[model samples]
Target: MRLAILAAYAAVISTATASYAQQSADPSGVWLRDDGNARVRIAPCGSNICATNLWIRDTSKGEEAGDRLVMSLEPKSPDTLAGTAYDAKRDRTYSITVQVSDRSLLTRGCILGGVLCRNVHWQLAR
Candidate 1:
């Protein structure tokens, strides 16, 4: 009986740890841009994932007032997401890949039909 109880407890603890790890691995929260100018909230849409501008430092710029779709991402791999990222201010769209981690978000946006690519890192906000 004692052995069975011990095994059950171990299973419960292992399951709980796995659940926590999975939740932490998911990047579904507000993240601060590396430039320190904006915060974006990432969440699931109808069938895909999207990130919208939640807040911005400059109000006069008319950036954060409207819910802007900055990123439309779909899972491509275990740790990578592929989609398009739009820059409303510049009216530009680029192919983007996002690599998500527990504390950081690394995104690479490609322009000119993949001729040019730029990387940006965003820190996960509490």
Candidate 2:
């Protein structure tokens, strides 16, 4: 009976450790733009995932308020994140694809009806 209990405990511990490792492998953190224009903080929202705007370089010119732009990101892979950005000002959706490179994040997508798309390369902020 004691040996059986030990085995059960070991199994539980192993499962818990594996779960923790999987969560840690996900790139869920604050990601900043290399041009110092934007930063996004990603975290889990219920069963889905959400990202919030953490910062922006300028607020005076051509800056849409990012506070209402919280988006849900679907995990395409262990290192890839895909989501749609809802622009509060324009009431439009933009495709967002982010690739994790070490500690940095490479994001590319478009607004303006997808006709004109631009790649925004972002780095991990210290």
Task: Identify the candidate with maximal lDDT.
Answer: 1
Per-residue lDDT for 84-111 in model 1, tens only? 9777667988898889887999988899
| Model 1 CA deviation exceeding 4 Å by range | 1-25, 59-62, 70-72, 86-92
Estimate TM-scores for all models.
0.65, 0.61
Relative to the unseen true structure, what is the C-alpha lDDT of residue 76 in candidate 1, on a scale of 0 to 100? 68
* Per-candidate total of colliding backbone pairs: 0, 0
Ten-residue region with minimum lDDT total, candidate 2: 63-72
Which residue pairs in candidate 2 have backbone atoms (N, alpha carbon, C) closer than 3 angstroms, thus clashing? none
Query: Which candidate has the highest TM-score of all?
Result: 1
Please report how far candidate 2 places residue 120 from its true position, in Å.
1.5
RMSD of each: 8.2, 6.6
> What does candidate 2's lDDT look like per residue over 47-111, in tens digits?
64555677777877655435545455666666777777665665767787777777876766777
